[model samples]
Target: MKKILFTGGGSAGHVTVNIALIPRFAREGWTIDYIGSTNGIEKQLISSMPHVNYHSISTGKLRRYFDLQNVKDPFRVVRGVLQAYRIIKEQKPNIVFSKGGFVSVPVVMGAWLNKVPVIIHESDLTPGLANQIASRFSTRICTTFPETVNAFNNRKSRYVGPVVREAIFHGDAARGLAFTGFSKSAKPTILVMGGSLGAQKINRMVREALPELTKHFRIIHLCGKGQLDPTSTHPDYRQYEYVNEELPDLLALCDFVLSRAGSNAIFEFLALKKPMLLIPLTKQQSRGDQLLNAASFERSGYCKVLQEEKLTPQTLVSQLREVSWDKDEYIQNMSRFQQNDALALLHQLITETAK
Candidate 1:
């Protein structure tokens, strides 16, 4: 039987694209193998998939800051490369696909050593450190944004637009309302997402402004693990550490979104036509990718940008109000966006590239 090896981890964004493509390959009777760090979130996300054979390896984060771990991580990455090489050699997969995270670098190198064709997907406007390294080893580079195509300056880069999950498009608004216990006759609902791990600053400010905010909109906050505030309670407000199957319902329920500027999440929001108030991570917090993503979205009129550096309870409330007021205009801009069939394109690329 034909087989394929996939690798990406460290964050939900890295694995979500793989998740969207996996079911398609499985339905076609292809054997699927996944490589990820032992305790990373990818393991938890992929563990429930019965058809996928999951393999764990040592992984080192590609950090920009000085830390004691930086000295030790190179050794771990080398170990991961060797382990990945052995696994790829044994599995002899026809092709390896990567979604561009720290864990994926070793996997791409292993695929190169094994003489297997590799395809890497970049979700950000500019490539991350891991993807930049993997790009040299990859047979082709798939990008979510059209501008990223020019960054490569090579024949390998292809713009496939965004690969959004099919389930996201099938959300039920009524179910969402029921799940949140929100009333249709009451205030509009706003979903606050701080990413998979949550954003502390955003969380704090949201709660701080709840007294003024709840008067205008009911709130549903996905506060990330261990970030929940017990003191903040209201008739119209609800908070979750995270949501799995229920996320679609929550997305369906919200009339507006307050979120961090992660590329994957923003694209999904854009696809859903949800007006968003984006507070991107500051340059110190990230490599400024979120800043660029938010800026791009703002330029396109799909969302309003709120810099985290300037984030305060008052600013949050004001920006959200502006987004709500300009909601129809944002929707009109989003309506003009036509995304290609990214999943199908990737499937075809893999099928054609695989030996």
Candidate 2:
């Protein structure tokens, strides 16, 4: 039987995308394997998912800054690559599919060194430094946006749609409104999120601004895993560290969303047809992709983008005050957001690639 391995994690986006496609691969009788960072939730995440086995490696971020810690990344990467090399040597998979992140670096390289066909999927309009570096050696590159086409610069690269989980891909908002406590005929509920790992600035601002905003709109906030203190409290607020089951339900119920401009979250929101207010992660952490995504989404009028430091309570409330979900502008903007059927497009790409 043919074997296949996946490598990418740290954010739920990477792992979730991989998980979404497993059922499709399994039906073809392929043996699936995974390699991700031991530091992340990947190991626990895939336990129940269908897979032959999974592996983990200690990995560090490749910071653009010239720091002493970054110097150590080389050693860590070497160790991770060796670990990946051994894993790959054992599996001898026909192909490797990687979502780009720091954890994927050694895994991607190991596959390349072993002469395996590799494909890269970069979901953001702007590619990450790690993806750009790895693209040079990949057999094919996949992108979520047409603009990201040039970022990969691979002749084999194509404009494939995004790979998103079933919940959002096949979700309905009427079903999700239960989590927001809003009747379907009532005002549109807003879903707030900061991805799986969480964002400090987003969490702080939402905590302060929500009580005021919720009076006007029903809200469901996913505060991220382990980010919200148990002591945190507010009336009419439903907070979750993670929503393993109700994720699709909540998103389907929402009218609008305030979230960090992570590629995965953005795709999920768009897939659900919820208008968005995006806060790009601080420049310090994004490796420049969040800023680019926010800009692109804003220019396209798909969503409003706000800088993290500039997110003052009064300013947020003021913006929310004018953001009437009933307005023609909101409808127009959201229409622009449905740029493509990302999931269907991705499925077609994968099917073609597998051929």
Candidate 3:
């Protein structure tokens, strides 16, 4: 049987695309393996897959800011590269597929050193620092946005769009309603997501808006790990730390979305044709990639963007109302794009490159 190795994850966004591709490869009878940080979210998510062999290596965070850890992380990264090199040499997989993250940098480098073909997928409008470094060692780079193609300026860059999980399309609305204790006779349901780590600012604003919002909408809040408000007992509000298996059903039940503008999460919402009000991370919190992702979605009529700095309880409720009013138009515009082809193209690239 053919064998393939995958690597990515500091956050859920980096690992989700790889998750979407795993089953397809498994069905085709490829022996699949994954290399990630020992305690990263990727290890938690991918380790449970029955068909995937998961390997953990030492990895360090790639930070743009100066800190004491910055001086020490380079050494960790070097160690990670050596650890990855040993894994690649032993596994001898046909190809290495990377969803770019700090963990993926060493894996891509190790693959290059082993003379194995490496394909890296970038889900942002512009490459992250890890991907920027991995791109040099990769044989091909797949992008989710057309705008990202020009940024690479490399002949290997291909714009294939985002890979959405198959399970997302098979959501059961009944199961979703049951999970949230929402009724059809009640107000419309809106799902609020703050990304993998949960955005405290967005969570705070949503809680503040609940009194007004619950009058017109039932809320299903995925509040991130350990961020739940235990005192919240609103009849129309439900809170979760996170949902893995039930997420598709939750998406099916939601009439709209209030979310961060991470490319993977937003694209999944877009594919489901859920109207969204996006509050991207500001420059103070991130490299501003979420801002660019939100702007692109807004420009294409896929969602509404609310600048984080301008956010308030009143503004949040107003934007939610606006998104409801404009929901059909956003769905109509999203319908014009073929969102499902991304996985097929990416799978083909990996298969052909492996040969």
Backbone clashes in model 2: 2
Clashes of each: 0, 2, 0
What is candidate 1's lDDT per residue for 1-355, written digit by digit as tens? Answer: 8999999999899999999899999999999999999998899888898689999999999898999999999999999999999999999999999998999999999999999999999999989999999999999999999999988846999999999988898889899888878777557889999988899999999999999999898999999989888999999899999887788889988899999888989999999999999999899988999999999999999999988889999999998999989999999999999899998998899999995
Better of 2 and 3 by TM-score: 3
- What lDDT score goes with residue 347 in model 1? 89
Give the runs in model 3 whose Cα sits over 4 Å from its true position.
none
Q: How far in Å is the alpha carbon of 271 misplaced in model 1?
A: 0.9
Candidate 3 global lDDT: 0.92
Which runs of model 2 end up more than 4 angstroms from their true locations? 172-187, 325-328, 336-355
Score candidate 3 by TM-score against the native.
0.98
- Model 2, span 105-220: residue lDDT tens: 88888998898878878888878777887787788888888778976665777886656677565655666655555555554566778877777777777678876777777667
Clashing residue pairs, candidate 3?
A: none
Residues 1-355 of candidate 3 have per-residue lDDT tens digits of 8999999999999999999999999999999999999988899899989799999998988999988999999999999999999999999999999998899999999999999999999999989999999999999999999889888856989999988999999999999988888777557889999988888988998999889999889999999898999877698999998899899999999999999999999999989999999999999888999999999999999999999999999999999999998888998998986764899999999999999
Q: What's the lDDT for all of these models?
A: 0.92, 0.75, 0.92
Q: Tell me the TM-score of each prediction against the true structure.
A: 0.98, 0.90, 0.98
Predict model 1's lDDT versus the native.
0.92
